[model samples]
Target: MSTNTTDIFTIRAAPGTDIWRKPPTTNICNAPTAIPPSTRSTGPLTSFLSACASFSFPWRERYDQAGILLAFRRRSESSDSGIPPKWIKTGIEFYQSQPQLSTVATDTWSDWSVTPLLSSLPGAETEQWTTILVEKSEDEHGKSIWVYRVVVDEQTGEEKSRTALREICWVYGLDGEWDLEVVAMAARPEKEVKDGEEKELVVKVRGWEVKWEE
Candidate 1:
């Protein structure tokens, strides 16, 4: 299938739920909280998304996130049906009370898994410019996997260094992985907001690409 990419799109989250998987207690997978109501779209299959932006979260909650969402729907399912059964989001996440590159994937009834892209101490934070990518590829075992990566430039002393950043992968079946799409930007609030409550989270996204199989 041909690949289609869209121009830069800015996504705003008004505060509520964020795309996450905190089972047994809260499962708001299908509909992500804190996402701007105006930017949600039901479109073509999208498999890859690369975005650069400055992120900010209203409250420093553990699961709070603002990043690229790789939403996947089953071939036999309706595009308008609730939310995609399987999906993945990777970017800056507040984990263990620290800002770390985090990726979360969900499957079947909001079952989710968290993968920390960075292993060192004091993970990256909300900076001026950051690069994040979520792509589907085959692992060394030749299995279909989703790769999450981050890149940042750091300066030590008088020398500047380009870091590869952090990377992590997860395996998923490719049998029914056709209907895919990317949410250019998405956010989830710490908790559900009240009727009159306004939780605003803005993420500036620049340069993005979307690709999928026909």
Candidate 2:
């Protein structure tokens, strides 16, 4: 029998008050830190990353996000238990009744921040499609950092706008090293039951790539 099956699977987060999977660390989101040099040799490296798609959510629901997410757990931690020590998800999210660029990072706990998108047009039911780029870089101090960028592209794959986002340390573990995983993530925070009709929320992601460092 052919082992291959022509089936599709989706990874979905449960609907909640918010999409955040952890508790708040503080009032202010902590700045990202640098990856330890020792870990660099073994290289939990990632690059040339991208994701693109269009999605629809209940207008102004304040509970939907779809894009690229990178999650890391300390190398010292057990692979069998608990959430990753740090993670970030970047994409279009509904907030304050407007769609904006949202990136939520968690270390020990979670913190969310938003940047207004240049693509957000007035009085639109949904915003335009987007591309997210994730890459690794070094600071003047020679520390390793992760850079996130939001790009707007034309239908022909021509560049329209590219906005460089804040860079954070590629590592989150203080005691030792970290194990990293990158994925396409989507979430819906609210459940809508309109007279027993299930409102199935969905998001799409495409054109993703991951190139390991040499």
Candidate 3:
């Protein structure tokens, strides 16, 4: 079976140097909210930290108008044989009925799901995570910037056995104001299975950087 994780490719940043947008949420396991000492999760911090140790972090931001935080989470809740498993994206700005991000005055918006890719095994040593940040340049026409990153661990800062596509913006317009432009986005794939292994996909994003696998 043909696969890409083992296939190496080179990726380089596009021309025109620019600044980078830091990821909104860092401590992925923890919710990005001002939880008072009294309202904080009573669970052991070690447990939360342990969970994050195996999975990649997520993105979190608040709606400008509603002041609701959109906490984008990744991890599988349940799985059926031969399936990739199911995940969810829950937060203040997401509507259960419409399931769209709450953008300023916009009520209906689309939500994203983060997938888990920890190597499944019996008593497999605790899996590791990798994290990375991709800097994207905005088009003069104000098109959505493309964000690409490699998932890695917190301690080692190593990427996951697989790579994923992520994009985040403070606001797409002037002074945190979102322009809301829709364009054909270059897909950052998570469930890519170029080869036959029931596992991760590692492929180069053209002119970006070399793809790595664990």
TM-scores, each model vs. reference: 0.63, 0.68, 0.25
Q: Candidate 3, 184: how far from true, in Å? A: 29
User: On residues 1-214, what C-alpha lDDT tens digit does candidate 2 reach at each position?
Assistant: 0011112223344444233555333322121211111111122523322233333333345545666566666556636334455667676777777777777766556667787765566763564556666555565765444545545444565556556665666342234655565555666666663455334445544444444544
Per-residue alpha-carbon lDDT of model 3 for 1-214, expressed as tens digits? 1111222232221212111121352111121221122211212111121011111112111110011122211223112222111111221121221212212111223334333323322222221223222233356565332332344553564555434344444323323211111100111122232354323211121111211121
Off by over 4 Å in 3: 1-110, 115-125, 132-136, 140-145, 151-164, 167-170, 173-214
Better of 1 and 2 by TM-score: 2
Inter-residue clash pairs, candidate 1? 14-199, 17-33, 17-188, 17-189, 18-188, 18-189, 46-180
Residue 8 of model 3 has an lDDT of 20
Ranking by lDDT: 2, 1, 3
Q: Write the per-residue lDDT of candidate 1 for residues 1-214, one digit (tens) a residue.
A: 3332333444555556565555566656533422333334344443333333334444244555667676777666754657566676766666676656666666643443344534434433333444565444454765344443444433421213233333434335456446665665556565665555545455565444444444
- lDDT of all predictions, in order shown? 0.50, 0.50, 0.22
Least accurate 10 contiguous residues by lDDT in model 3:
179-188
Q: How many Å off is the CA of 57 in candidate 3?
A: 9.6
RMSD of each: 6.2, 8.4, 20.0
